[model samples]
Target: MTDIKDLPKKSGPSGGWGSMKGIKRIHAESHADPAAFDTLRRQNKPGGFMCSSCAFPKPANYKPFEFCENGAKATLWEQTRDRCTPEFWEHHTVESLKDWTDHELESTGRLTAPMRYDAATDRYVEVTWDEAFQGIAATLNRLPADDVVFYSSGHAGLEASYLYALLARLHGTNNLPQSSNMCHETTSVGLKKVIGSPVGTVIWDDIDATDCYFFFGQNPGTNSPRFLHWLKELKDRGGKIVTFNPVREQGLISFVNPQSPVDMATGRETVISDQYHQVRAGGDVAAILGMCKAVIEVDDEAARTGGELVIDHDFIAEHTTGFDTFIDFARRTHWSDIEHHSGLAEADLRAAAAVYMEHDRVIGVYGMGLTQHAHGALNIAMLVNFLCLRGNIGKTGAGVCPIRGHSNVQGQRTVGIAEKAGLVPMDKLRELFGFEPPQEDGTHIVDAVEGLIDGRIKGFVSLGGNLARAVPDQKRMEAAWARQELTVMISTKLNRSHLFPGRDAYILPCLSRAEIDEQATGNQVITVEDSFSHIHGSTGKRTPASPKLKSELEIVARIGKASLPPNPKVRWDDWIGDYGLVRDLIEATYPDDFRDFNERMFEPGGFWRGVPARDRIWKTESGKAEITTPPQLTSLGYGEKDGRYRLITMRSNDQFNTTIYGYSDRFRGIEGTRDVLLMNQMDMAELNLIKGDKVAMVSDYDDGEDRRLGGLSVIPFDLPRGTVGSYYPECNVLIAISHHDELSKTPASKSVPVRIERDGLAQS
Candidate 1:
C-alpha cells in the first residue's frame, strides 16, 4: 500500500495478470483460508452462490471460472475471519470511532451480535434477538407511518426484499427508498416511460449477436469486471466498440481474458473501443444529440436521392410515436451549440455516427455517467430516442442496456421496494395481504434528508448500505441523521452510518449473501434478478461467520410480527420458516413474471421476467414506444461561470459504492490515497498548480450556504478541460442536497461546479 507520489500511466490493460494480482491482494487482506478458495470455486455456478459484487448477468454457458476480480474481492471480503464482537464494542466508543475512515470502520469486521447504543456509556451493549426486534417494533409502532423510512441496499435477495417490503406495507408505510436511488433510478424512470420496461431488454445472446456497441459513461472494468469478458469477445469477433465518457477508462480501452490460456501465456490484450470520446462532465445529452443529428441528416440525403433509408422510417411509422417531433428537434439543434456543450468536435461525433450507420444491430450500454445529473432521466430518454431512430428497441440484436451496480438493486425494486405508490399495484397488495397499503408517494433520499433535518422524519431502518457516506451533502446528512428518534441497521459489517445513530439506535447482525441460511423448514436458497431481468436462485454452503447472525428475511419477519397485530392473510412467521412461501407470495403479486417460482429455482439458468419492450409491446398510455425530445439538447443545468470547474466524482478499482476495499485504484495508476484530484495538465498550469499541490475546493451551487472540502492533492491526468475528477464519499460533501435530477431525484454526484484554491489562501 505504498503511495505513488507522481501520477503514473495505467499499469496495463484491464484483466490480465493485473486481475490475478488483485485477487491475491484481497485474499491476503481478508486472511482467506483454503476453505474460502473452495467457496470461490462455487461462485456463479448453477447450484452455488451468486457473486455479490455487481449485477451483470451470467452467461448460459458460463466458463469454469465464471467470477471476475471484483467478484472475488467481494466474496473474500465477506468471508473474513475478523469479528466485531461484544468485546470489541466494550473497548471502543461510538464517539471515538467517528474519526475513523470508512475502510477502517468496515474493516473492524463483521458484527457478531445484536447491539443497542447506550447513551450513558457512549458504547453499544449486546442485546438479545427478541429484545432487539421488540424494541425496534415498539419504536416503529409509536411513530407515524410516513415518519419512518425503510431503506435497503442491493445486498438483499429477492425473498428478503419481498418480505421486507411486506413488513413496511403491513406497518402502514410506503417509505421504501434503497441504494438504487443514488445510482440508476434514472434508468428505471426514463426507460419505463419510453419503452414500457425499466430494465435492459438484452440477454447474453444479444451481446453475442450484436455487431456494434455504443458504451456511454460507464467503466465496466472497475464496477462490473465480468462485462469485460463480453467486450473482449465482441472485439475478437470483429464487432466495433465506441465509448463516450469523461474519463478515458482502461476497461473500455483494452482487456485481456484471464481465463483464456493463450491470452495469459502471451500477455496479449484485445483492444476494446474503436473510438473513445472524452466528453465533458454533464454533457452527454449534447453529444448524443450530435450523433442523432448526424443520423437524421444522412437519412434526409437518402430520401432525396432514393438511397437506402438510414432512419428506419418503416419501423418508426409502425412501432413508435413522436418521431416527427423528436427528429425536428434534432434537426434544428445548431452544431456549434452541440460542440460547445459536448466538448467534442463535430467531426468526432459524425465519425462515431458513421460507425452506427455501418451497423444495423447495435447495443447501447451505459452506467451512472448519464444518470446522476439534473436531466438524468432525459439523458436516458434521449439515448432510447437515438436507438429508436434505427429501429433498435425491440430488435433481435439491438437495445438499451443500463448496467446496474448492485447485484439485486433492480430485483429489490421489482418485488416492491419503491417510494411511489404508482410504481407498484396497490389493489393487488391490498387483496393479497388483506390490508390497505399507503397510496401516497414516500420520500426519496433527498426528501428523507430534509425531513430528518426538519423533524418530519423520526425513524430510519436500513437493510444494508452506509447511508451517511453514500449520499450527497454528507456534512448536512450526518447532522440530520443524528436527530432521528430511532435508527436501525440490519447489516453484516459495521459502517460509518452506525456511528451517526439516533437516540435509540440498534445494530442487528445479519447473514452475508454467501453464507448458509438454515430455517425451520430446512436449508434455504434465495434468488436475485440480474441487470437483464433474468431471475436465478443462489445457494450458499459456506458456514456463517457467527452463530448469532439471523437471515435478513427472518429479521424482517420478526420485526413485522412484533410490530403489528396478527393478520391471517400475511403469515410472517410461516414465510420466515420457509422462504418458498415468500416466493409463492411474490408469484402471487407478480404472477405474470414469477409464475412457478419454486419449480424454476432449480432450473439451469432460471427464466427471464419478460420485459414487454422485448416483444415490441409498449405499456405506456399511447401503447407505442415514444421517442420524445428533451426541452434542450444539453444536460448540464449549472453553468461554469466565475472560473469554477465542473467536478466529477468517480469510484476507484478498489471500491464498490461506499465500501472501500483498499487505497489503490490500479486502473487509474493511483495508490495509497483517495483524496487526490485528477485534472488536465492544461487546467493545472492555468491554475498555477502542479502535481502534489494541496488545494481546497468550494462548491458553486445555487444553495445559500457554501460547501467546502480542503487538503486535496492535485494530480495531472487525462480529463477534459474545465473539468476535474475526485473519488466519491469524500467529495460527496461538495454536492448540494438540492442539486439532483428533476425527474428521479438522484444526486448529481457526477457533476458539481467548484473552485479550487491553494491550502493556505486567504479568504476574500
Candidate 2:
C-alpha cells in the first residue's frame, strides 16, 4: 500500500491559475495584444469590467493592471479567438455535447450566433435573433407571470440587473431567483433579523483600523486574495487576526500577494492569522456559543470580585433585550460539550475571548463556509449576538462582513431581486409598475428546482449563469430542465447550462464587459455595485466578439416589449435602447442613495450608498442592535457510526464558485485532477482506508436514494476527525434538495452525512 507521505508534491506558481495544468491553454489560442487587455483593466476607464472571479470589492485607487490570474483567465476565456458557429454545432449533437467534460465544452469557445435546439438532429441549429426573441416572447406571454422564473447571475452589471428586475415586475412576476439564493441568502436573512440590514457594514479601510479581526468559515487567500492587502496592513501595525474554519486552508496561514512585486521578488509570504482553529464541520454555531459563554463566565467572575472584566456591560444593559434569556442559555452550555463539538480546547476559546475583550474595535468576516450548513442561519445569528454584546455593529473598524461570491450579487439583492415574504420592496414595486406583482411568495433556487420537478414551473429565463451546474443534484436538475417547454438563456460564452436544452430552447449570445457595446445610441456605459456597496461606471474597451451578440439589457428589454401588451406609460424599448435611461429610471424608482446615478458613477473612485450601521445607527425595530439567544444544543442529527464521515463541498484555489478554472488545487497538493477527497489520518486508519483507495460515498438521507456519487480517490491529511472535503459542483450531487436551511432555503452544502465504503463494496 502506498503511504500518503510518499505521494507526489504538487508544483506551480504561487497564485491564481498559474498552478493549473492548463496554464498554457489560453496562450495556445490566438489572442490580441497585451496593451488592449491592459487598457480594459484601467481604472476610471469606461470599460473597466468587474472581475468575474470573486466579489472582492475593487480598491478605491485602481492599479494600472489590476486583474488577478483567475480574472485574466475569465476575461480571455470570454474574449477568446475560438468560435462555436452553426457549423460547429452541426458537427456535435446535444447527446455528444452532454458527454463532453465541462472544461472541454467551455474551451470550444464563444458562441457567435443565436441557436435553437433541433429535435430532429438532437443538436442546436443557428437561428436569427428576431426569431429567437419572438419565440421567447410567445412562450412568456402564454404563461402566467407567476409560472415564469427569471434567474440572474452575479456576473451581470447593475444596469443589466436593474433592467431584469424591471422586466420581471413589469411582466407581473416577482419570481427573480438570483445567485445569492444559493450562497449568501442566510447572511441576508440572519443579518436583517438582527441589525435590520442584509449587507455587511465593514469597508476596506475598516480592516486597517480594527484592532482585532475574527474570520469565521472564510479562506481569504483563495476565496478573496484582495483581502490579503488589508490583512498585511493590519499585521504590520501589530493587530491580530483569528480564524475559525473546519479545514486549515493554506490561505488562512500565509499569503504572498502576487500584486506586490517586491514581496513576490523577495519570496516573502506574510503570516495572516495570529491564531487558527479548525472547528468541526457544522460546528460554527457551537464554536460561537462557546466564545460567548466564556465571555459571560468572565463577566460573572468579575461581578463577584467587584472587578470589571466584561467589555460592554453598559451597551448590553441599555441597547439590547432578552439578555437574561441569552445569558441563561450561555451559562447552561457545558465546557465539555463545547470542546467536543468545536474540536478545540476551552483554553483556546478563552484566549480568543480575551483578545476580543482587550480590543476596542474588531471586525468579523465570514463567507459560504458558515452559511452552507443546516444551522447556517443560526450560525450567523450567533455571530451577530457576539458582536452586539460588545456594541460592535455600528462603530469604526467593528462590524460583520459577509464576503459575497459574485461581483454584483449583493447589488442585485439591493435593487429588488428578492422573494422575501411581505417585503416592503415588493409593495413599492406594485406602486411603481401599476400591476400588483405576485405576492404569493415565490420560489428560491432550491424551491425552483423542486417546483420544476413537481411540474409547477414550465418556463425559465436566465439572464447570466450556469444554472444547471451551479445548483446541486445536477442529474435531477438536468432532467427537470428537459421537462420545460421553454428555456431561454442570455449568455456571453458557452457553459454547461446551455447544453441543458428544453424542447424549445434558445441560447442568445450577449456582450461581455471587456467588449465595446455599440447600442442604438453611439456608446454606453454600464454601472456595477461592488461588495462594499460602491457603485461605479464600467465601459467596454475592446470590440464586441461578434455582431450577433447583444447586451443583456437589450435582450431583456426586447423580450419585455414583445411579451407585454403595448403600454405607452412605460417606454420599455426606449430604456432598452439606452442603458443610461434605465439607470435614471432606477435612480427614480429607488431614490435612497442613487439620486443621480449617471453623475455619481462618473466621479473617480465611484460613490458609496449610505450604510447607516457604519455611522452607529441601528435600523432595527427598537432602534438598537439586538442580542440573539444561542441555538439550542440538539444532536447534530448525524448518527455517527463506525466508518461514517461528513463530506463538505469546497471550491478550489484556482476556481470560482462553479466555474472550474483548472482541475488543480495547489494549496492542498492536488494536481491534474479534482477527483480526490481530503480525509483525516485517524478516520482513514479507523475505516481501514489507505491513500489512493477508490471509495464510494452514499448519502445518509433516505430520500437521496439516487445520491450515490462515487469513484473518489481518498487522500489523508491533517483535517479534523469525522470530516472530509471535496470540490463543489462535482460533489453537489451528493447533497439532497431537501437538505437546506428552512428559513433561507439554502442547501446545506457544508454539512452532508455520508458513509464511505471501498469501491463496489456493500455497507457493513
Which residue segments of model 2 deviate by more than 4 Å?
Answer: 1-36, 43-47, 424-434, 634-639, 762-764
Q: lDDT (0-100) at residue 266 of candidate 2?
A: 74
Q: Which ten residues in a row have the lowest lDDT in candidate 2?
A: 1-10
Candidate with top TM-score is 1
Q: List TM-scores for all candidates, in order.
A: 0.98, 0.94
lDDT of 2: 0.76
The model with the greatest lDDT is 1
lDDT of 1 by residue, 1-764 (tens): 00112223356889999999998998888765557787788888777888888999876687889898889988888889888999997789989998999889878788899999999988999999999989998889888888999999999899999988888888788899989889898888888888888888887668889999999999998988988888887887899988899898888777889999999999887888888888989888999999999999999999999998888888899999998988888889899999988999999999999999999899999999999998888889889888988888788889999999999999999999998889888888989988889888888888888788778999999998889888888988898898898999998888989998899999999998888899998888999999999888998788998999999999988998899998889788789889999899899899999989998875666578898898889987789988878787667777657568888899999988888989879888899999898999998898788899998888888878768888889999889998899989899889988888888888888888888889556322
Cα RMSDs, all models: 3.0, 3.3
Query: lDDT (CA) for every model shown?
Result: 0.87, 0.76
Look at candidate 2 and give me any clashing residue pairs.
Answer: 46-539, 47-539
lDDT (Cα, 0-100) at 465 in candidate 2 = 87
